[model samples]
Target: MIERELVIVGGGPSGMAAAIAARENGVKDILLLERDQYLGGILNQCVHTGFGLEYFKEVLTGPEYADRFIKKIRGLPDIEISLRSFAVGMTGDKVVTFLKPGRMERVKARAIIMATGCREKTREMVHIAGTRPSGIFSAGFAQKLINIEGLLPGKEVVIVGSGDIGLIMARRFVLEGAKVSGVVEIQGQSRGLVRNIVQCIEDFDIPIYFNHKISRIYGRDRVEALDAVRVDENFNEISGTKFALKCDTILMSVGLIPENELIEMAGVAIDRKTNSPVSEELNKTSVPGIFVCGNSFKVYDIVDSVTRDSLAAGKLAAEYLGRARA
Candidate 1:
């Protein structure tokens, strides 16, 4: 077993920020573990520019914002980065077990930071009744397919939510020469930022159906169409309001849930509704010497906020280590 002063369980914006802050606060031994081959996490696939306004005082793309911190981490010799390391287990005593390419390793640290981030809600989570089809995808997964893999998901698309990602992807599909039939939302107003609603929807003249939902999806091999219905203020389907939309793809942008299962496995109390850690203070969890930052603690809408809170988690880990030594 390898031992370290700090072990950070993610290498995205949160993990990188925490590592930098901990190093600045005099925590020398630091390990940053990333599951992906690259360190940027979801930022790697986010190519649009709306990030780093508050943190860097400049607008940057997702990759660009992540690059700034990645460069800083490379320059700091005290921080160790392990890419493609999937953390599998965490003990109450801060022992993290992760699996790499061909080997599994364990690290026991004086302080541990979980920057595991969050996952998107799927059709099942939203109780959308549909035949399991090939063209259904989460908004984030579609973003990755288009941005990173350089492949379009489909030619005709229908987004099933008015969240930020769904709004942004509506523009992306149009830019890529695909037809966005419309966006369906059960709420009266969009859940996304106003700026996104303007830039991604109204600017492109994309149709958005407010107080509507995709009640049923129709397809056998791939997505053929969707059964949409108008909902009352209580989200109940109104009689004789069902309609059908023809589309080849369906994208779900319902919501995001914090990834806190590993922390819960380590005996940390978690809020069932939000799936976030129950913390007394910011970045401080119920368990001592184990801190959580970024979306693992709470889902933030912007990356800048994630960086801000993660920096604090790093400092807290450094202070915890100092007390452990004293």
Candidate 2:
């Protein structure tokens, strides 16, 4: 068992920012844990620019944005980083048990911050009627496949959501020499940013079928074709509006859910509306000594907002430790 004044459960944008903020605010003992082998979280896989525009006033890629913070985090003393670590269990009194390398370790902290990020919605979550196929993937998975692994997911792609990831991936597929048949949205309006809609879909001349959905998918072993249908305002498929889109791949980017299983286990009060922890202050959760920030609090449209929110969380966490000591 290890004892620390503060323990951050994630090493993404929020976690890194929180640790830095806490250290600057006089929190001496801090430990940051990440499940990935490195820090930066999902930002590492995001290769696109348009990040840090609001925060840094410069156009940058996701890695570039993360690197800026990581550099600062590395320079801070008394802040330890543990990679390839996962918080598997938590006690009622704020003790966290984690798995790292070949051993299980426990850390008791005066304050804890959860910046666990979010998870992409999958085909199973949407219940898309289709034979189990190989070419189907979440937009995040496809992004990681292309950016990190240097591999294209497929030649022809049909995106099933108009959210940011799906929209961004539509352009990525085109840039990578893959044909994006269309971007389909079940809702009438796009759920993504206006710039993404214009740059990713409209700019590429990729068809966007609003009030439409992929009703069914067809393939034996891999994706061959999919059935697209126009839906009414009520989201019911209209008669005689079904069409076939021939594509080798389907990317699902319907939604993102906050990763808060451990927080829930710790008996934190959750906001029913956001499905995230109920935060009264900038990042203070209902559970005292346990702060929630970033996507774990509520999904932010931009990374700049995440950093701002997490900076406050870190400061508050430091204050919490200070009060405890006083």
Scored by TM-score, the top model is 1
Q: Clashing residue pairs, candidate 2?
A: none
Clashes per prediction? 0, 0
For candidate 2, the per-residue lDDT at 283 reads 80
- Regions more than 4 Å wrong, model 2: 323-326
lDDT of 2 by residue, 1-326 (tens): 68999999999999999999999889999999999998999899988988888889999999999999999999999999999999998765889999998999999988899999999889998877978888999999999999999999999999999899899999999999999999889998899999999999999999999999988999999999999999998999899999999999999989998988887888888876567987767787778999988998888889999998899889889888873232
Clash count in backbone of candidate 1: 0
TM-score of 1: 0.98
| Residue-by-residue lDDT tens digits, candidate 1, 111-221 | 899999999998888898878888999999999999999999999999999999999999999999999999999999999999999999999999899999889998999
Tell me model 1's lDDT, rounded to 2 decimals: 0.92
Query: Residue 38 of model 2: what lDDT?
Result: 83
TM-score against native, each model: 0.98, 0.96
